[model samples]
Target: MIEAQGLFKRYGDKTAVNGISFTVHPGRVTGFLGPNGAGKSTTMRMIVGLDTPSAGSVSVNGRRYAEHRAPLREVGALLEAKAFHTKRSAYNHLRAMAATHGIPNSRVNEVIEMTGLGPVAKKRVGGFSMGMGQRLGIAVAMLGDPQTVILDEPVNGLDPEGVQWIRHLARGLAAEGRTVFLSSHLMSEMAMTADHLIVIGRGRIIADAPVSEILAGRGQLRTRVRTDRPSDLLAALRGDGTTSTFLEPDLLEITGPDPRRIAEAALRQQVLVYELTPLQASLEEAYMELTASEVEYSSHDLSLGPPAQGVSEGSRS
Candidate 1:
């Protein structure tokens, strides 16, 4: 298990983490989510002792990370995918890391196969692709068979199959009563893999709860309505704090009102409703709502400027 109490990190005049306290228990995967410049990476670094905390404390497996005689056996971290020697082969790199902890040569080969890097095990690290580098990083993290695993953006450069493989690996580790702490920007995949989430914004924790609870709390129940007279059905729900969007000529996505309320409104207006399906809120929607005002850098659509006199649409390139 990983525990942080009032953890804080400061860089000169800027503060990265500000008194954030949370616990990651064993036997489940906990996702770390935040926007850019939200202090997620700094927190992860502090957990592994990469950067010293300005104040407060964090521990892995009931002890500080540095206090462990064999640190790899206590916690395995993959914070950077390309932290290996540029000229060393994948197999050689693992052998070197395992040597530091007196791990056997057999274990090196085992991790090479476990991470699906056997085919390219003899290749130089500098020539490897981003996906291959990620696989190597994971291989090193699992080399020690640690009780707690901490991964930062493990799926950043992976393909669909690789992504699925990492997801399974995380869940499989948790099933064995190990702690899995993962950080990623892919909400769709995170929703499928994580049992709980720790959301941070502006150097402070905004939410720390189970996935189901956050989803249920962040978004309201919405109903998808299909009818012959779309505008008429909308008119029936004039007030009552309801909002809607026209998906098609005969279809509308109604928000705020429940299915029963929408059905009653349509029936009263004789709108001839054909479909009234309830839509569950997705993780992406819930995340957006939670971090709506917490985003440090907001992006807006760039307005297109007029073309030059001699430039045509097809000739611009």
Candidate 2:
């Protein structure tokens, strides 16, 4: 597991990361999410000992990354895929990294096959495509067979197949009881891949919870009720804090009341209820609602033109 307590990082007068604390447990994929300039990379860098923390502590498997005799075997990270020498062949690169801790050459070949880099293992890093480079980077990270893995935007330049491969790889790593912590801007992918979520904004932790709990707690519960008697049901359901909207002649979307209460009201008024389905908020919607105010940058229009008129045919010509 990974533990961070009161972690902070500052550069001169600017604070990149404020006091934040969170734990990433093993046997689960914990997704780190944030908008641009939200200090995600900075925190990841601190975890791997690439950046010095101004205050507080972060440790992997009960020890700071630098304190480990074989740091790579303790924590495998792909902070920057392009940090490798561009002129080196993918095979040689992994060989060099493995040589650091006296890892065997056979282990390097195993990771190459595992990451689907066997075919291009002999190709130079500079000639590899973005997706190939990402694969190579992952291969290097897995070379040490670490217990804790950290990947930043692993699917940034991947195709659909490559993205799916990464999703499976992360879950597989966690299933083996390895701590998997990753950051990505893809909400849909994160929703499908992550078992838990950690959201950060403005140099501070905003939310840290299970994916299901975050979805259930961020927004009000809504229900879709289809009844034959729309008007009568609407009246019977009318009360303080209750709201209803008609999607069609017989379909009603309701908020501020549980499905059981709605059914009770319908039965009390002798209304015919055909269907009642609870509608839970999606992860994307919950994320937006939670981070709406925490966003650091927003667009605003400053133009003072007379509300530009529609273009005419002559203007198009």
Candidate 3:
């Protein structure tokens, strides 16, 4: 497991990470999400000892990452795909890393195959394509077979197949009861892979909960109820904090309660509910709603009308 307590990081007079606290437990993939300049990378860096926290504390398992005798065995991280020496072959790089922690060559070969880097294992790092480089980084991460795995934008340069591989790999590792903390800007993939979520914004943690809870909280209730006794059901549902619209004589569209709660109220009033279907907002929608105020570098539509003052068309380019 990973834990952070009142964590804060500052560079000069600017605070990159505010006092944020969160726990990433084992046996599940916890997604770390945020907009640009939200301190996600900085927080992740502190977790793995890449950068020190200006205040508070963070630990993997029960100790600081640097305190572990075999740090690589405790945590496997893929922070940068192009961090290795460009002249080294993928195979040689893994071998060198394994040597640091007494990991065997067999493990090196195993991770190479696991990451689908076997075909280019002997190729120099500098010559590999982006997708191939990502695979190599993953192989290096898995070399230690650690209990905790942290990946930052693991699918950044991946193709569709490579992206799918990363999703499966993260889920597979979590299934083994390992602590999997992943950071990604891909909400759709994160929604499918992560069981829980932590959202940071403007250097602070704004939301941290199960993925379902986050969606349910941010999304309007989308329960369609068809009933015989509409009046009685509406009266009962009014007390349950629902805004309803009559779609027909017997159809009700509810926007504040789950189907189960609606059912309970219908049952109490002896109303016959013929249809009850639940729908949810997409993860991307939920993320936009949650981080509506947290984005630091938000984008807007480009001005198409005319050039600005003192700026020529060629000068703008």
Candidate 4:
């Protein structure tokens, strides 16, 4: 497990990471999410001792990273995929890394096959494609059979199959009782891969919860109701906290009420309801709503002709 308490980082006058505390438990895939400039990379670097913390502490498996006798065997990290010698063959790169930890050549070959890098194991790192480079990086990270794994944007350049592979690999690691912490911008994939989420914005932690809880609390539940008597249904649903909007001549999108409530309201008004469908809140919607105010840089749509006074550009989206 990984635990951080009041972790902070500062560069002169600017604070990159505030006093944030969170725990990544074993047997789960914890996703770290944030907008650009949200200090995600800085925090990850701090965890592995790449960047020193300004005021707090972080530990992996109950000890600081540097305190581990064989750090690679305790925790594996892929903060940057291109952090290897470009001229060396993939196999040689892993061999060199394993040599530092006294890991055997047999273990090196095992990771190569496990990461699907066996075919190109003899190829130079510089000539590998982006997807291949990512695979090689993962192979290096797993070389020591670490109990904790950290990956940043693991699927950045992967194809569909490669994406699925990483998803299963992350879950598989967690199933084996290892701590798996990853960062990604792909909400759809995160929704499928992550069991929990740690959301940060502007150097501060915004949310840390289970995936289901976050979705339930962030976005409103909406229902789509289709009926020939749209007017009667609308009149029955018009009240405080209950709104109806007409999407088509016979289709109405109702908010602030569930499908059962809308159906009963329509029935009491003598309206004919042909369809009532509930729209569950998606992870994308929940993420956007939670981070709406925390985004540091936001683009404006000139077509909207300047946002209203005191309203943020992100909110307009």
Candidate 5:
């Protein structure tokens, strides 16, 4: 359970994060997504007390991170991978951090094992690979067993298996009623790992809603209708609530109408209804539609409709 309200951050004249609000609910993974320089990291930093917001506040389980009795146990964050001293062994580094909060060495070992770093527990962190470093960061995040877990770019350098592991891990944490917030640029990963999505662009939130809602709002619902009497089928559904585009001789792509209705019209008109299928939109397409205008680097043509509707909601089946 994490809530951010009217968060604003400025660096001189440039605002890294504008007034944005979103909530990370328990028992589900909420994804934070945006293009580069979109202030995702800055927002996360403010949540963990690393940077104070200029306007609003961020709370974890109804309390600011700084006000928690044991902040580590209340919120565990993996903002950076391999943040420990390079020369120190992973076990020793964890042990040292555990000492600050009176956590036992046994807990340290448990976390080490939990993160699949047992073989490298005694090894120096400097020699660890990027994947290993990511694993170590996850280990440290779980060291305190916090109720809310915040991970920024958790799969930055992870291999395929490591990425899948992180997905499962995020889901498992949420299943336990813990708040899991993950930020990533990979749309496919977010599609698989998150139940809700919070998208930001130019330091402002573009969309904050359920994953299905965000995808549906992009309006890519198109159905392919194959019938003997294509003209009649098109005429029957074209008038009031539908937008039909004839692609081929016998194929009509219909939007704003369900497949069942299209089939019913064909059957009533004595037309042979060959096929009717609904098309689904990809998360990548939805994300691109939402952030196309706010992206900092724009090599693609922006003359398209609203920059956000460059990819029209026409489905091909």
Candidate 6:
């Protein structure tokens, strides 16, 4: 497991991380999510002992990274794939890394196969495509067969196939009871890969819980209700224990009441009901809603939502 206890970092007058604490447990994928410049990279660096915290500390497997015996065998991380020597072959790069811990060639080859880099293992990293470079970086991280893995944006330049491969690899690693701590800007990826989520914003921990719990805790639950007499249904739903908002004349968005209860109320009030589908905000939509203000850069003009149909003034992702 990886633990950050009140971790803090500062550079001159700017605080990059502000006393945030969280844990990454074994046997599950723990996704670290935040907007860019939210201190994610800084926190990961501190965890791996690349940067010393100004106020607190982080430890992996109950020991500081520098103090670990056989550190490579305990934790493997791909913090920055671009940090590797560009002239070195992918295999040679892994070979050099393995040599640091006296790991053998066989293990290097195993990771090569596991990462689907056999064909390009002998190619110089400088000439490899971005996807290939990402694969090579992953291969190096897995070289030590460590119990804990940390990957930052592992799928940054990957294709659909490569992304799928990484999803499977992360899941497989966790299935072996290893701790997987990763950070990604992709909400769809997080929704699919993570069993738990740690959401950070403005250098602060916003939410840390199981995926279901985080989603539930992050937003208010609303149910979509369609009835023949939408006005009556709205009136019936707005009471001591219920709240309703109108989305359309025939559809009323209701909350604070279960479907069964709403149905009973509608039936008792002679409101003909047709549809009642629970509404949930997609992870992407929820994340955008949560971090909209936290984003450091604005890609679109807020005043201009988007261009009209067949127009190209701005686009929304």
What's model 2's TM-score?
Answer: 0.84
lDDT measured at residue 121 in model 3 versus the true structure, 0 to 100: 92
Off by over 4 Å in 6: 285-293, 298-317
lDDT of each: 0.89, 0.88, 0.88, 0.89, 0.87, 0.85
State which candidate has the highest TM-score. Answer: 4
Clashing pairs in 4: none
Candidate 6 lDDT tens digits, 227-291:
88987776776775667778888888887777887888888998878899887868887788777
Error of 2 at 309 (Å): 26
Error of 2 at 12 (Å): 3.4
lDDT of 5: 0.87
TM-score of 5: 0.84
Candidate 6 residue 101 C-alpha distance from true site, Å: 1.5
* Tens-digit lDDT track of model 4 for 20-115: 999999999999998867888899999999999999999999999999999999998988678879999999999999999999999999999999
Q: Report each candidate's C-alpha RMSD, comma-separated, in the order given.
A: 6.1, 6.6, 6.5, 3.4, 5.4, 4.7
Cα lDDT tens digits, model 3, 1-317, are 99999999999998989999999999999999987678988998899899999999999999999999999999998886787899999999999999999999999999998888888899899999988888888888888899999998888899999998899999999999999999887688789899999999878898899999888777776888999898898898786567888899888888888888999998999999999989778889999887777777654435754523322323212
* Model 2 lDDT tens row, 1-317: 99999999999998888999999999999999987667888999999999999999999999999999999899989886777798999999999999999999999999999989888889889988888989988888898999999998899788999999999999999999999998976677789899999998868899999988888797687899999998998788788588888999899999989899899999999998999999988888888877666665533343733224422222212
* Candidates ranked by lDDT: 4, 1, 3, 2, 5, 6
Please report, as a residue range, the 10-residue window in candidate 2 with the lowest summed lDDT: 308-317
- What's each prediction's TM-score? 0.89, 0.84, 0.80, 0.91, 0.84, 0.87
Report the number of backbone clashes for model 1: 0
